[model samples]
Target: MELKKRIEKFKTREFETNKEFYLGIEKGQNPHTLFIGCSDSRVNAEILFQARAGELFQIRNVANIVPRDDDPDNNLSVVSALEYAVKVLKVKNIIVCGHSNCGGCAAIRKLNDYKDDLPNTAEWISQSSRISDYIDGKYPDMNEDNKLVLLEKLNAVRQLDNLLTYDFIRQAFDSRKLNLQAYYYDIGTGDISIYDYENEFSDLIKEIALS
Candidate 1:
């Protein structure tokens, strides 16, 4: 009922007010950025970006994962959007945004617990298992809460490396035709920390890539 009312209000109020803007974009879309974010309900891309309609193309998925080119189980849904965003839309920026208290990232930490009941989720998030293992091995003394936070941030940045595995993405990045960034949004604090492709996690991501 609440959602239906909101939709009705959007049609009667918001749409009427911005009728021209909406109709102008109806013919075609020219979004400037490709925002790849988590499927977390709390992380609303438009609200966070303060963007209007037709401004951003988006891909939302568990843990905000982008499969590497070499990944045998690469999910076509995500890769297809990415390819279209870059090749067809010619989006100048690609932002992979992960957020705090992410259930998906939390699941990756205890993936074995879900392997039986949530097999598909377990397999999907298993892509970032190496990142979790690295944190455990390197920060053995870090508390659970802090470890999760670190994992969330690193996992966001790691997707940038995964994005580079695509030849077209790498070419665009190398030629400065495309910009890739990772963002860690703290839902509670209303803060977002942005990371460039070559950030603190670059070395770690390189090691993981080599492995």
Candidate 2:
């Protein structure tokens, strides 16, 4: 089917089925959480969270990176959305979610493979190379598959850390007005690993809460 047909189908089918939901959306959006995630087609933040309309303010990017607030030359969209969500929307929770089989993380593992041809993508993903450093320093013996998994989890943590670089976020966190979390999602098995900044990744609790 064509894009317009798909949209019309949604308007008549899904939207018609959820008339009240769209009515509330039409009134205004007052999302309670900010979901920062990768732009991968398979990772739909709203679907994964089973979120209703206006429940989540979402920002999706190449690698789900949170560039440092001081990095004025990069990630203006993310920064703007974040400011609006936190400052204007007053979202109480912020989650940085990374996924398995992420092409962006894979590019980091094989940086040389894409650096020459896909320079822009390489530059964007390279911002999260701290995950590579963690892999090197902490899990040097891990196999390629395990390494990618570790990278996926670590990238979420790194982005969470980056979130604190913003003074507003730091203030919100410090005052206990907002919560920050990191999550690693397995696309194949639908498993989600939560990251606790206080402990090593292995020590954190892993859950299989698909519903």
Give per-model CA RMSD: 1.0, 5.5
lDDT (tens digit, per residue) of candidate 2 on 1-211: 9999999999999999999879878967898899999999999888888987789999998879989877766578889999999999999899899999998998998887898999989888888776676577666787889988877887887777678889999999889899888888999999988775556452321111110
**Candidate 1 clashing pairs, residues 3+ apart or interchain:** none
The model with the greatest lDDT is 1
lDDT string, candidate 1, 1-211, tens digits: 6999999999999999999989999999999999999999999989999999898999999999999999998889999999999999999999999999999999999999999999999999999999999899888999999999989998999999999999999999999999999999999999999988786678877876666
The per-model lDDT (C-alpha) reads 0.93, 0.83
Total backbone clashes of candidate 2, pairs 3 or more residues apart or in separate chains:
0
lDDT assessment of candidate 2: 0.83
How much is 65 displaced in model 2, in angstroms? Answer: 0.5
- Please report the TM-score between candidate 2 and the true structure: 0.90
Q: Score candidate 1 by TM-score against the native.
A: 0.97
Considering every candidate listed, which one attains the maximal TM-score?
1
